[model samples]
Target: MKDNAPVFDALDLDRHAFFFDFDGTLAEFTDDPADVALDARLGLDLMRLLRRTGGAVAILTGRHRAEILSHIDPAIPVAGLHGAEFPGEVLAHDPARRAQFSPLLPGLSALVAAFPGTLLEEKDAGFALHWRRAPQHEQAMIAAAERALTELGPDWVIQHGKFVAELRQSGGDKGSALRRFMAEPPFAGRLPVAFGDDLNDMPMLAAARELGGLAVAMGERDLPADHRLSGPRALAEWLERGLA
Candidate 1:
């Protein structure tokens, strides 16, 4: 672990831009993604954080726009689908790309059928096979992803998370999301502070630290984050202490 500082103190040094990952960061992960909900205390803490940052907060998640908004309910801009700039829909560039990826879902779904506890999830620009409930089948799940990618073409890439392997469309990531946000009003000229708990989040974390702000790892992971917190509860408590 590197030398970490109080987040509030870091924000106090200059104008700060806040970016957060949804699952495993703001909220705990659930077997069923639909079962996940934003904690009320998080809402309150976010409300306070927003007031302090002057509305420079955003959610950078792998979820779709509707799914993320329905939970967090923050009026602030969100970059979902790994920074797809979901306005009206999650896809920012081409609508047909989603359709292109849709046909591949059934194949991926079938690939996970042999594993009883695995799940096949389709996202706006991609799909995933989660094996959190079936840890023993991880290698098989990964093999399935590799086989799917061989047929899916080079337009997609495989990413890993806690017991989950995913395939998201090319061209965008959380780092690009943060960069785009940094170029906009309220966020421009401000230092960025990012938080996340997965490997895919590394780009955004590096982006934040590179921009001279801060990156925080929400859970235990070997990553570069100026600060670290045990979990969402610890994060909330830290925010409260800052406000106090």
Candidate 2:
């Protein structure tokens, strides 16, 4: 993590809403996703601070709500499944997208099974094949996934991340989730601040910036962020400052 001050002012805290990406932004990344954990005391402090400031906070993550919920305090609002699902809101996207792509899964499964080293993760609307444990074939698997996605057509979008490649419905992303949140109560009419790390978080960072808010990029790997911090500890420290 870098120790540079982000170009943000304390005055912007008034009536602000905060949205955060889970994995890298809120917790340290782990080889096994299940190993990620939150700092319970810090999380409580931040949540309390946001509530006291008349601001709302939410988590926008690529993981399933259940997976994310297991890592963070349950009280926070969450948009999960990469915006495919929201808290208490039925998914607006068509479930049939998965069905349409079902035919391709067999081939994908066969390919992965033969690889012997990759880990296959199946979601309701997408699939992610992780090659973190099998560095030798990471690039090959990514290329295969890309080709499969291209052959599968525009309905499917292939997203690449650290040691993983995912195929999901093209329309659902963190930007969509943030936009949807901004349109609703508790989140609307407030400064929109988002913190994230990774290429997948680029849209949310852009959205926050476009909305006249601050976008803080977390971790060492860079994309585009209004402010860049080294890791979650720095983020927690920044939040403790209250923009004041």
Candidate 3:
């Protein structure tokens, strides 16, 4: 959260489509994921941005769409489970994919059970093992994710975040989601502006730049971006400036 990143100019609401990452970008990190909350003021700001941009705002998150809704307004469009879930698009491989993951659940549960502070989060395409409450178990969680990947075969991969490791299907990511969103109404024909704070967000950031738009890095992840801000507070202030 160092303030080393310079502030950039306000976005032109009419021409730019905004894509945001939730945790570590819009909201601060929490020991317990269930305790994470979206700031009411930021939610209102997002609603205003949506209005100003002709609804060109969306969230691309690792959380499930339903789970994300518990924190934010359901009116805002969200591509959840790292884009595995989209608005009204039923994935043909969903059931098959879920079945593949079902068998691994018992083993994963047993793994976390050995680590008192670790938690398992099941998602549409896969699952995540969080070690935030038990940093000492980080390596074990990662190894577990790697082992799960082997069992799931080439179609699956491991995604490492701040204090968590996830095992999910390969291909469906924030970048793909961004590209898909850019092809649709309200998002099409506009420059993409992505904001993120971690390794998992690199694809989305790269996509924004590849699409001839801005990539804003939040926090100190050393991410390649056109602009950067310290963290969520800085982002909130930056959004306020854009609104002004």
Quantify all predictions' global Cα lDDT against the true fold: 0.81, 0.79, 0.88
Which candidate should be chosen as best, given lDDT against the real structure? 3
Across 1-244, the per-residue lDDT of candidate 2 in tens digits comes to 5566464456354577888998878887776676788877558766775666464788998888988877667778789878888988765555577667677788888887888678777887778888877788887799878877887788788877778888887887898899888888778888788888887888888888888888888887777777788887877777667533
Find the 10 residues in a row with the least total lDDT in model 3: 1-10
Positional deviation of residue 162's Cα in model 1 after best superposition, in angstroms: 1.4
Q: Flag regions of model 2 displaced more than 4 Å.
A: 7-12, 92-95, 113-117, 240-244
Clashes of each: 0, 2, 0
Q: Return the top candidate by TM-score.
A: 3
Candidate 2, pairs of clashing residues: 1-230, 10-243
Model 3 lDDT per residue over 121-216, tens place: 987778899999999998899888888888889988889899999888888889999999999999999999999999899999999999989898
TM-scores of the models, in the given order?
0.91, 0.87, 0.93
**Which residue pairs clash within candidate 1?**
none
Local lDDT at 196 for model 3: 97
Model 1's TM-score against the true structure: 0.91
Ranking by lDDT: 3, 1, 2
